[model samples]
Target: MGETFYIKNMVCNRCIASVLDIFGKEDYTVESVELGKVSATAGKKTNKSALASKLKEIGFELIDNETETLVEQIKVKLISKIKSGETEHLFQSLAEEFGKTETALSKLFSKSEGMTLEKYTINLKIEKVKEYIQLGQLNFSEIAYSLNYKNSSHLARQFKTSTGMSMTEYKNLKSWNRKTLDKIV
Candidate 1:
């Protein structure tokens, strides 16, 4: 049976590919790799210390604590939700998905992450907004609608609060700054 290793800061498909490459280089038999987790059989040639160091060098962490693993899982799920535009009843949905009460999950997230879950979600949403703006495909109203904001003005307010600039100002910038999903915090 393959062992599962929880990872920190794996936020996208590229991260999965990077993990797969690392495992291959380490000569492990990888069963599967996904956001925040990998299932693999360690071969004789596999040096776990080297693997962990490689991951760390590339801005990832091998999560050994059960609580830290759970927190990373929560982060991965939240990122997926934001990407899929499922922003309604977030706490309730997450609670049901994790089979835990909202309060319990919130407390756990805050304790592990040093930020409230709500703040994390907002940061994710703001990053998504920056992406859409950079793409120049959607108007402000459309972007707001896609992200499930009540209205464009509400999105505008939140965007300003999060980014320290209005959407128009961001668009007019010579260089657009965007955060990688894993670096949202």
Candidate 2:
């Protein structure tokens, strides 16, 4: 069986692709690559230390502690849910998904991340909103709907609160600055 490695700071499809590339270059037989985890068999020529170093060079960390691994899993699950726009009962669903009580999960996340999960979720939503605005394909209402906001005005309020600028002002900027998914915190 291939060994499974839990990774930190792998929060998007590009991160998965980057991990796959690193494994491929290192001659590992990659079975699968997903957000925050990989299953792979090391080839005879593969250097584990080198592989870890390369991942680190690109802002990914190989997580060894069990608690840290679980925290990374929580981050991956929450990011997946947000990307899918599953906003209803987010906390309750996350607890159920992990087979833990909401309070337990909240405490664990808070202890490890040094921020409340709700704040993290809000940060994610704001980043996603920035992406939508940059794309210029969707209007405010459409973006709000896709992100499961009550309406454009609600999204606008949250956006202004988070970003310190109106969406129109953001859209009018000469350059848009959006944070990478893994760097949300």
Q: Return the top candidate by TM-score.
A: 1
lDDT of 1 by residue, 1-185 (tens): 98899999999999999989998999899898889999999999999889999999999999999789888998999999989989889889999998999999989999988999889999999999999999999999999999999999999999999989999999899599988988876
TM-score of each: 0.97, 0.92
State the displacement of the C-alpha of residue 32, model 1, in Å, after optimal TM-score superposition: 1.2
Candidate 2 residue lDDT tens string, 3-42: 9989999988888999999999999998988899999998
CA shift of 176, model 1, Å: 0.8
Candidate 2 lands at a TM-score of 0.92
Q: Model 1 off-target regions past 4 Å?
A: none
Count backbone clashes in candidate 1.
Answer: 0
Q: Distance (Å) between predicted and true CA of 54, model 1?
A: 1.0
Relative to the true structure, candidate 1 reaches a TM of: 0.97
Worst 10 residues of 2 by lDDT: 176-185
